[model samples]
Target chain A: MTGDQFPLWAAIAVSVLLVAGSLLMLAGCIGMVRFRSFYQRIHAPTLGTSFGTIFILAGSVVYFTVTQLRPAVHEVLIFVFVSVTTPVTLMLLARAALYRDRIERVQDVPASKDPLDNAEMQTSKKPS
Target chain B: MSRVLPYPLLTLSLLIMWLLLQQSASPGHILLGLAIALLASRAMAALQPEKPRVIRFLPIFRLAGRAVVDIMASNIAVSKLILNPNSDMTKSGFLTVPLELKHRFGLAILSCIVTATPGSAWLEYHPEESEVLIHVLDIENDQEWIDTLKYRYETLLLEIFG
Candidate 1:
């Protein structure tokens, strides 16, 4: 059977890794729905992108290493890309949200530290 | 030597990536990967970007190990926060930490490390003031975070990039 393609121990390890990774992702999704504010919600998705991606990639590495009998670590490229891009995109979205909030004068959001944005915000508020 | 191979590390990594992607170690594949890596590295040299010098190997490895452990720990911490309906988020808020690690590459690596952790996010950085704005999911003690960041990460990064 195709089930016997890999050893039982490898199968068990892969299964555990996959399940744990998916549960982390599911928790991240639940967090997205549960959190109240935009800034709070922003932290939720990182759960999936960080260790969640690493765990799943780890499972792939283990399975491929067992079957192919070679170190198959190219899956690490995905983790690298995710780790780099996730923060960049998250930072951009957060800055955009902050800018919008500052212009609208949301009470909790701190004023812009960026002088250029500070000037633009000043103009945006004064014109209103 | 430096002229032909502007970045030995970059070329070597690209070659390794090519071989891994192709999943082969044949002589022809190695030669082809070398050629591609050489061409790509030359293109990179055209940009004339200052390469980050990882001066110390030990701190680099240490930082990587620490980041992995912290990521796992924070995953559990964030998951607990998500699962507990009664968990209050009043303690969650933004933190502004002034940084002395002025090296651009050091700052970038620190940002990646901070943002990669699940319970924290890197929001913005003001280079003029040399400060970073981060959002922490659970910040019971602000000083603790500031200390952890400055001592744990920024110090290691400064060593590596220095």
Candidate 2:
């Protein structure tokens, strides 16, 4: 209604992006609650982290770019940081969980092996 | 170039990231970013991580495109599985797949791709055994997941990194 209102097409695109992002994030949280085990729970939040965050950030980028009348790409930093850091934290946490499961002898975890010898055996088995 | 910047790509990306963060490309910011990038690359040199070699560039883009499509499809699949009340949880399980790709950087990228996709989490990777264990949500067929990784991702990664 106002003079400052977003253009119709831009508004539609932004709305769709934001809605899809929120839905993905909501689904991710639901997955966390619905899953049965720690391992399973780990996969849940990735939904939010991967495409969810990307969609939301993209929406922000589109909205700001239109409003500012310039290329507003700074939101990409959040995208890059989130995409990189989430995996690192998740990987570390997964490794820690693996270590704990091995130490505690928790059920269903693959057994740990000698790092050095295992590498050698794999290399030796290479067909080349 | 090597003497001044051990990792030219790292330095360039760091400088670009600094400029992007500050949202400026003025001379002062450029100078500061260059200095920071130089210092950071020097610091990185001390750690001495193995240098990643990208043999073919086109496959990287192809892989990225495939990943985006796959992630989008899997996101829908996973959301449906999670939302369904009657879906069985017992079907989800951990799987170990042997890998032939040996480059450390390639392996790292593969893990990121796997984890970033919804419904799959990279659990444990044994470099010596050339195997990685992943926790998959709603894994109806183990061979399907194995083929997805080995053929879809690993082959491209080997082409790029080897």
Candidate 3:
């Protein structure tokens, strides 16, 4: 809120981070539309979620830390949470997509293999 | 110590997180954070997920630095692909790579690393076959991606976890 009080170096850093973060998110959106297939499109949003969120939140952390004259590191909670949760959600979505593709008899995706049988076969083969 | 806190590191981190969120180091807040952290660790102990033993701290730092660099590089690369007028020049496809790292904790970290990188996404992992299916936005060469994963992240993860 107090732009005048914000130091020049912190201001430049925050601005750079904000610009870079927004650009990454923009690229992600562009990829989501540009990619041909569902699988290809899925990789797009991670750009925004991973480093995009990181940069924006990091800028916030720096800005707040400078302005507040305290650590103000709570922004890290969002960073940690986003970094952890994004992969989980993406993995689940990917699995669901794979399942749907299998049901529909999609051509590109490999056929679903039973996880238990696969494990057993591996273990049995290792003994030889 | 074990009885009081099942996961000392987890409890300590949670306490730090709580204090950060509160933005104060008052005695009351510290006590409350300690209580919550203890309770959360106890709950975690009940779940009993594989406790990842980090034998080396240096590898963790190295991995973190490597990840940051990779993410930054990929972000630029992917941005270029997206912004290019002739995007069709780039090929996007799936590639499955066999993995030697079998530790669940290590695999999870690997998944996060792969998925977090802009151009790659972890599609499916077969625990039994020790293979991971990843979709690459630009699949110029499959072996290169495999080598990058194996050398860049997996080796560091093996060192940290083992």
Residue B70 CA displacement from its true place in model 3, Å: 1.0
lDDT of 2 by residue, A1-128 (tens): 23567799999999999999999999999988988888888888889988899898999888888887556767888888888888788888998887666655678877777565445544553232
List model 1 lDDT by residue over B13-114, tens digit each. Answer: 999889888888999999999999999999999999987777888898899999889888889999999999999966789899999898888888888888
Return the candidate ranking by lDDT, descending: 1, 2, 3
Candidate 3 positional error at A53, Å: 1.6
Candidate 2 clashes between residue pairs 3 or more apart in a chain or in different chains: A118-B128, A119-B128
Error of 3 at B153 (Å): 1.7
1 versus 3: better lDDT goes to: 1
The TM-score of candidate 1's chain A against the true chain A comes to: 0.86
Q: A92-128 in candidate 1: lDDT tens per residue?
A: 8988888778888886987777778878876775323
C-alpha RMSD for every candidate: 2.4, 6.1, 5.7
Q: Which pairs in model 1 have colliding backbones?
A: none
TM-score-better candidate, 2 vs 3:
2
In terms of lDDT, the poorest run of 10 residues in model 2 chain B is B119-128
What TM-score is obtained for chain B in each of the predicted models?
Answer: 0.93, 0.95, 0.95
Q: Candidate 3 at residue A35, lDDT?
A: 80
Q: Please write out the lDDT profile of model 2 over residues B82-106, one tens digit for every residue.
A: 8889988778888889999988889
The C-alpha lDDT values of all candidates are 0.86, 0.86, 0.85
* Backbone clash tally (model 1): 0
Per-residue lDDT value at B57 in model 1? 82
Give the CAPRI rating of model 1.
medium
